[model samples]
Target: MVAERKTHPYLSLMNSYLIDSPQPSSISYWYNLGSLLGLCLVIQICSGLFLAMHYCSDITLAFDSVEHIMRDVNYGWLIRYLHATGASFFFVCIYLHIGKAIYYGSYRKPRTLVWVIGVIILIATMATGFLGYCLVYGQMSHWGATVITNLFSAIPWVGNDIVQFIWGGFSVSNPTIHRFFAFHFVLPFILAALVVLHFLALHTHGSSNPLGITGNIDRIAFHPYFSFKDLITVFFLVLIICLFVFFSPNTLGHPNNYIPGNPMVTPASIVPEWYFLPFYAILRSIPNKLGGVVGMFSALLILLFLPLLDRSLYRGLAFKPLSKFFFWLFVFNFILLGNIGHLHVEVPFINLGIYCTIAYFSYFLIIVPTISTLENILFYLGRSNK
Candidate 1:
């Protein structure tokens, strides 16, 4: 009986995938984005630790401490640059990972909570990054904080109070810096928690693979095949980050930020970090203060509703021509908005923003459903041949 059991089917299959699964047939590096995202998180955390060593939490010395690190501490400039550039890279990976989810319908049905948690993590990351930027305490830092927190003033009843409470005064100051530091440290742990929860949820539903296929019988185990795949991805990501850390550490930061915080002087145009450009465009697009706030936040809020909005019977965008068109259109429009956000608000820019913003929403709320129906019609007619 023991000899006969040597080839047990279920155990043998599990062993094949865990000890070894057949090498992936045809796959691209894009499939490694999820693991690349994981690698980015690790980089952010490690660089943040070294920077934190010299990062003074005290209000009086915070700016000077940054200077002292750069001027005196060994390789302090390197540490600072790595942390800053890493932030931008982290956002890049995050957006790609999120896009991967959207294109593959990873947000649908059983994986709804996974996507929802991912949104929450993105929001927290935004908050964490904003706080990190503010901690730099440059003119851009002050102006960025001033503009962003002041948006709360658009609230109907308790707007001013909320803003004051957050600022710890009428404007950004000592309390703001201290509080931001507190939250910056605290929120990442929250993010780490959300990531854990996100992973747990992903396991429950399994990942939405490239082919967008359903069922698990044909699915390979996650251990060996995926583990090695993730390992290779992580290695490549580390190499890229190291090149930046060594060669172009300051490539992503603004030149103005090198200057110390000055309440009297403001930069010609205060732009938030690049990762925030699309929402910044949405914020500036509307003329009204409260309306702009609503529009800005709604852009991100709209993403949370995607699973519900994409009613297409087909899962992957690749197979659905109409859906593919809208997906690319939406992506291009978003990139256009990000570009427009960086420009001075000219008539052409504003007009472009208006058109693209409409196109952006149309891709999600309107075009998706319309084309989904069209897809169903096509499928129905196509089936008649069978």
Candidate 2:
């Protein structure tokens, strides 16, 4: 029936694949985050493009141009605020989306590819966010870029060359800003394409429900049912973001960023945005420059192995008693690391950050795999006794 409609092939494909797709009826409001993430991506891209229209990527004009947008350009402040705030909210939605997946065991079996693509999207988003932040050419932006890009120098013999390559000269200057701005503009479209692939992969296996069941007994069409649900969720989320944009536009921003970039002086402390703090904490925890760089990248790259590391047969945390406890512990540990990341690199804070970083890695590398194996073994033994 879908094929016989004789409409445009693209429209017909969307109707057959998306509008008429079957989704698990037991899926909770948590599943709405997937759609919310899509909306956030669109908001970022649209607002970013408009801001780019009047943005000057030159080091001298970059900071002042942003000021011009805020003070002179009609509704430019609205667009700029939306783009900035949307980046933070984008992470908010993706983190919740990931948490939902972890709780429901969405990364298992056939959907593993979907999870992998999602992780890639996350990495690309991080890169894009970092580049966008640097385009502001403020105190934090300048020092942050200098410090982060120089981390490449930790790479043995080619370290200096890598840093020079990234700088496009001897230091972070006009060429560096121009290159970062170009990539920042281009990467979002690549991310959008990856998101399309993510949806294709998701549809290949359908969505995982809160119950973690794959049965067809309770399923519904994606049209009016889930569509309206997703719409409502997006609307609510946009309302919250709008509140932040209008009422407290700078709440998520740092005070240091208000000052224009000056190579002559450095801020007392350099910090990335809140969303990057957990990994940043891991980076700063290690004493060695190379080791710290490796640790930071490992923190993110290790997530790729989560589907393999978690050996439990149970599909959801709800069914796994011990795993559930560890899951929330991991969450708390992550927040602790983020808090530590914001503190000065002195005395107790450094020690605390190191400890939290260890806890963070241990959760995935040691605790999850070990408890999962032990729990499965005990389950089988109990069943045999019964």
lDDT tens readout by residue for model 2, 153-268:
99999999999999999999999999999999999999999999999998887888887677478788888899998889988998999899989999999988989999899899
Q: What's the TM for model 1? A: 0.91
Q: Which stretch of 10 consecutive residues in model 2 shows the poorest summed lDDT?
A: 1-10
Error of 2 at 43 (Å): 0.6
Instruction: Compose the digit string of candidate 1's lDDT tens values, residues 1-386.
Output: 43333378876644543444433333346768766766667767787877788888676788888898878989888777777877888898888888878887878888899999999888889999999999988778888988899999999999999999999998888999999988987777788888888877766656665666664546564566677877887887778878887887777777787788788887888888899988899888888999999988888888899888877776767688778877888888889988888888888999888888778778878887788888988998999978
Measured against the true structure, the TM-scores of the candidates, in listed sequence, are 0.91, 0.97
lDDT against the true structure, per candidate, is: 0.80, 0.91
Number of clashes in every candidate structure? 1, 0
Runs in model 1 deviating more than 4 A are 1-28
- In model 2, the runs with Cα more than 4 Å from the true position are 1-8
